[model samples]
Structure formats: structure tokens, C-alpha cells
Target: MSTGDGVDEVAEFAALLTELKERTDRSYGSLARRLGMNTSTLHRYCAGEAVPQDFAPVERLAEFSGATPEERLELHRRWLRAVAVRQAARPRTATTTEPEAAVAEAVLPEAAVARTAEPEAPPAEAGRADAAEAAGADSGGEVGSGGGPARRWYRRRRTALLAAVTCALLATLGTLSALPADRSPSASSPWPSSSADTSGSAPARTTAPAAPRPSPTASPNRSSSPSPTPGGDSPTPRTPEPSTSGGTAPGDATVPLTWTADSQAWALGCGHDYVVAQPPARVPPPPAAQDAGPWAAAQGAVHGRETVVEITVQGRSTTAVVLTALRVRVTGRTDPAPGNVYAMDQGCGGSISPRHFAVDLDRDRPIARPVAGNDTGTPIPAVRMPYRVSSTDPEVLLVTARTQGCDCSWYLELDWSSEGRTGTVRVDDHGRPFRTRSIAGLPRYMYDTSARRWTPYQ
Candidate 1:
């Protein structure tokens, strides 16, 4: 209560807790609901009526309030002090019989011997018992003149308590010593599942990438023959569109290949299974083993995590189109692309799962468009195209989709022209395209399939 130079630690702690609750702007009911605890229980915590034995709820509440590191640390220290004080105030009672008997049996063989040899006293001894009581009354209830039994019992009990306390302290120190330095007890990391997302708000219109699913076979199957790889001759011909130029045409050799992208039109979902920079292995992790951070609000929006897509052109040519102008669309007019897949436990949960479509230069050929930001389970009505690069240039043409929010696996398709040659590369981003990007393309950091580990893309 004092406003003087000296601080009231208990009052200050209570005030801090109260301030944190107010800052969250959420009613006790809402907080309790999200945390799955009773409102009065949370109230008791904020009121400082009693310090909680477990700090899990406190850590969660701190995260919800978005408390800074310093404030969280201070609050934790306050709780520790309160718990220590409360524990110390409790009265201590010890039963001397058990410990004393054990010590006597171990250290004094004569004590056990005397117990076994004891028998009923004779009638004449009854007179001696009365006389012995009279002497004992004068000696203040001591068993013997020196009170050896009482002294021995007290000494043994004190020693046993001290030994137990020492063992507990040693065990605690040993456990702490084994933990990693960076992973010390703190507010930033309450547990493996309780890490906070400090990435902040991501660029608008980003979707949490889902676990890499099977490649769309619709597009590749439509073509009678296998689609030509990048830098190879295209079996299909380039059918030019009507020329807009007074003397030349839009699709003519004189005009460069053009494409457009409506970046804002693409909507990303908040709930995705995984977000890895590279393609996932053919044997995907089991449903239970998948990382589900995207579903957690505490981890923040999955769209916030950036996925980098890089595009590179190897052969130089004036006929090349703007790489960014291309849009993803279905390859066929009547073919249905793979529908938007929802992550496990995310059905109709307000996540706008993006639809996968084959990327092409043409915009109006039954392309799959992104669904409304609020809708879920909108069937992808277009073709799901695998990752591909098309170009005619003898030199290598490269394109990197340098964006974020890719799952542990994803898809990409690319088409381009160089050196008067048009070639197309089609493959799954989770497969060869993803591997080439790391092996021969650029140097970047990607999450490995291993649990909580990172590996270099070389």
C-alpha cells in the first residue's frame, strides 16, 4: 500500500496481474472459454487470492494478453515468491515413533533384543512399579535418569528430515543441469506446444499451405503423349491469337508472350497441415504425426509464414514474357481439377482453402479461380496441373515462385520461350521441381521432414 521508495512486492504483483487482464479487453468468461477453465478460477488467479500450483494457465493467459518478455518474467517471479511463502508458513509435524524405531533397530541391536525378551512383571514387582512411577514423576516423565530414549528419538527424527530435504534439493539441481542452455525455463517457451508466434501480421491474402498431397493426374492424363520436359520440343503447336498491332498480332512472333496475375484474387486458408519449403517424400507422415500449428491461433495465421518462389531465365531472348504475368489455371476446358482439400479437423471451419490449378499462359480456358475468402470445400472445377517449365531457348530457363506459405509439399507449373524456341516444364513442386530448386537452383533454408529440424537446400 505504501507509495514510498520501498516497494510492496505482494501488492505490486497483484496490480500487475490485474493490469494484464485489463489489457486483453476480453471478459473473464471469454478468457475462460478459450482456456477451457472456470471463470471463478481465473478470477482467483487475477485477484491473487492464491497462487496456482501449475503455471500452464498463467502462461496461456499471458500469451492471450500478448504480454512482453519482461512483464511475463516479473509475473512468474511473483508467483514463485508467493508459493514459497505459502509453503513456508505451513506448520510442520513429525511422527517420532517410526523414524526412532528404524534408527534404533539399525544402530542398536540391544533395543530389539530387549523387546523380544520382555515379559509380564511378577506381582511383587507391582510395588516396585508404584515406586518407579513416583520417581518418574520427579524426573518429569524421563524413561531413565539421563532421558536417553527421548534424546535418541529427537536426534534420529531431525537427522532423517534433514537427509530427505538434502536429497530433494540435489535431485532438482541434477534435473536443471541436464537441460540445454537456450531452453531454460522462461515465458517465451512454456512447452513445445506453447511457443508464441512473433512473426506479426503477414502480407494480405496469404494462405497456410497444406501437407503436400498427391499430384493432380488430370492434366497429365489429358495429353495422349507425355508432356515434353523443359528445354525440349513441345509436341503441341503455339496457336497465336489475333494480332492487335496494325500490321502485327498479339500472339504473333513480333509480340512477346503476355500473361496477367490477380494476386489479390487468390485467397489462403488459416488451417493447413504443414508448411515446408521443399516437396514432401512419397511416404507422407501419418495423420497423427502431422504438424498442426496452422490450426492454433496462438501460433498466429499460417499465411504469415512466407514461402519463397524464385524464377530464373537462363537463355536470353526478346520473345520472353514477363514471368510474374502468368496465372495458374486448369489445362483443359471440361476437365475437373482437384478440389480444395481441407486439413484434418478443419471442415467448414472458416478457412478458405485455396484450390490448386495448372498454370498456363492462356487465362480463359476453364481456369480454376480462387474461391471467396470465407467459403470452404468449394470443389476445384478446373484442372490441377503439375509443376512444369516450357521454353524453346537452347539455354536453361528458370523461374522461382518466391512466395511463402508452401506446405511441406506443393505444386508448380511453368511455361516460357527463349531463343525462338518454346518449351514447357511440368512436374510436381513436391517432387522434381522442388528437388531441382534445391540441388541445382538456389541456396535457401527449408524445413526437413525430421521432427523439429532444419536442413540446408544445397
Candidate 2:
């Protein structure tokens, strides 16, 4: 081992792996699972054992580790060095009593190192060569000249370009799937095209917006409603009243309405079949789907990907609320949202074998994932609320209600994400996931008909 002039053979090898894991922000467990190896065994590999000659799992692990493009190439280089050393004969470094020497003793056991090479060459010598190469480089950023800022920037750009191309290919496939069953024009249809929004030439069909599910409400029958045709029957209590372009009320039109169980609330899953209204806080006024005044209008654009929808009731209504289901898309990336995508595998309340569901921030439905931090592995309880418009196209906030633990708090944005095509979840200072300073509303509580009780806190 040498000082500034040379790099320590053992230290450099270990540091490379450590940095790779850090930059990828991947857990050893996740890496192992992706590689189809026992998690404990994978941890041992990450601990600096030589890779087995069997490289299938290793290759896949490299793929999903979320490394930048440059990092992938580096991984390949490091792996090649590891294999080269495995094929060679290596001597065990001496264990010594001296403090500095003791530091050189690796906690990793030699037996764990993958022995893939012919025994003629020694691994110790191969490792020595690798170290010499690394130290000779001016910086750790580049392979030939040492990794410098310019080199690092070039590597990053290359990686991003590759990712963009990959995303584009996937998008093209997804675009095809987004289209309707048939491309034929129907006399009653307006938007004559799917995958494209050019429909001004289509027929004049009354397009109604989606209806929102209220939090908890005394209006027990509000969930379900019969679809209404404008010129038909007498006015009913729960018709889907549509707002005209001019915001004018209809005097001669009598709309027939009916209530049906809210399909949107049940979107959460079999058990969570309810919306974010967990227990209703305040009974909302009529038309929970109204555009309302200027307050409800969107102001600007968000950086990442996002989706917004509106709902309206045909008859008299006061309050407006939103229910959401959230999901993110960044191929090969794990959601930054905390708490494992809100899987209630055990069943909501207490049903056995309920269907698995997640909070897909990408959709206009109601489910959310809760997450914990590095120090705490326990996931937080969270759900998706309606995406509000304070700014334009913002990454939605996936709010979790931690009724207890770490003291009662209002909402935990375990992970806030947008649809910008960038798939990473961003965390802020304190290493805590991103959070907003003041969430809009106060805690509103209500009763759950299924639970037959009231939630204790917000």
C-alpha cells in the first residue's frame, strides 16, 4: 500500500463497489432479488467476494441497479478485473497486530470470493495490477486519464442519451396500446382518434367529466347514480349534471338522476374500496365535481409527469373533492414513494386474500404507498388525495396519515413525484423524503361504514 503517489490495492476495489451502490441508491436486498439470488448471499457478494464464473445473475443485477450509463461501464470493468483475479493464483494478505495493518484485514472472507480461474495465476497479483491502473489515473472519474469533471460529464451525457432512446422505444409501444379497439368513425362520437386528440370534426356527443368521491358524507346514497340523457325523464337527486361552456344554468331541461355505489372509491382495492375520505371530516356541499371559481383552475406547469381530471354533478351540489390512485413510470427505476406501494395483501380491515393494489400516482384513482426512512425500516401508512392545483403540472404529493408514532402529524409525503419522464424519487435535507411546508386542509374525521367505527386521528 502506498500514500498519495499510489492507491491501496484492497481499498480501491472495495470503494468502487461502495460508490456504485450509493450512486444507484439500491438496496443489497433489491439487488439480490433482481439477480434471483438469496438476499443474504447477494449481500456477501456486494461485500467484495469474487463473482462466480456464472455471470447471468451478475449481468441482470447490473442492469436494474439504476447506475448511470457511465457507472455501468465502470461495473463491467470492475467485474472483468474481479474475474481476471479469480482465474489467477492469489496469496492471502498477512494479518498483523499493528493498528494500520489491522485496518488492511478485510472482514470479507477469502472463501466467499468466486474462484473461477485456472489456479496458475495468483489473485493477489491480479488485484495488484487493478490497483496500479486505478491509482495511475489522474482522477477516479475517467478510465484513461483518470475520472475528471469533463470526463464525468461526458459519461453522464452518454448514459442519459441511452436512457432517452430506451424510454422512447417503450413509449412507442405504449402509445399503440393506448389506442381504442377500432379506428372507425361513429356518428355519436366526437374525439374520432385515439392516441391523438384531433377530434373537432367528429360528431356532437355530450362529453361529461368524471365525478369525484366525497370524503365521508352523511349523503349515504351519494356514491351511485344513473347516467342521464338531457331530454329524458324528470329531475332526480343524483344525476351527473354537466356545466355548460358559459356557466349558465338550464331552465327548461329536467334531468333524471339515480344513485349507484361510487365505482371510484372502490378503485383502491377490494378492502380499501373507499376513497381517501378514510372517515369523512366535513360533509361536502353539492357538485363535489364542480370546477368552482378561479381557485380550482390550474395555474402553471409541473416539471415531471402528471395527470389531472375534473368531475361534475348534474343536479344541485355544494362541495368538491378529489380521490386519486398514483403510479410512476421510469423504466428500471423503483418508486421513490415510501411504504411499498400500499399493498394490503392481508385484506383491508380483515379480509383474507384480497387482491393486491398499489397507489399508482400515475392514474386518477385512489390508493397510495407509505414509506419509511433509512434508519427506520417500518413503512408509513399513506394514501392518495385529489391532486390540487396551486401550481401547474406539479409532481403530486402522496400523503400518508401517521395517526400515531413519532407523535401525531398531519401528512407524510413519503415520496412526491411528477411525470417528467425522470423516474427518480427526490429526497430533501435531514435525509427525510420531500415534504410540503403547509398542506392545505385541517384534519377532517368521519365514520367508516365497513369498519363500523370512526378513525381515531387524521
Q: How far off is residue 1 in model 1, in Å?
A: 18
Q: For model 2, how does the per-residue alpha-carbon lDDT over 1-458 read when each residue is reduced to its tens digit?
A: 22321223323444555554443334666556546788777665556654556545554554433333334444444554455344333454555233222212122123223321222224654465456557656455434356533344445654664565456546544543443221122234222233454455443232233333334532322222233333333333233333221122241122221122211122123212111222233322212222221111221111111111112223211111112233322122222221111111123332222122232333333244534323244332232232211111112232221111111111112121121111111112122221111112333233344664444332
Per-model TM-score on C-alpha atoms = 0.25, 0.27
TM-score top scorer:
2
lDDT by residue for model 1 (341-378), tens:
21222222444432333222222442223222122553
lDDT of each: 0.37, 0.31
Worst 10 residues of 2 by lDDT: 403-412
Clash counts for the predictions, in order: 43, 53
Model 2: lDDT of residue 123: 67
Error of 2 at 422 (Å): 7.9
lDDT of 2: 0.31
Candidate 2: misplaced stretches above 4 Å?
A: 1-14, 24-26, 90-398, 401-458
CA error at residue 29 for candidate 1, angstroms = 6.8
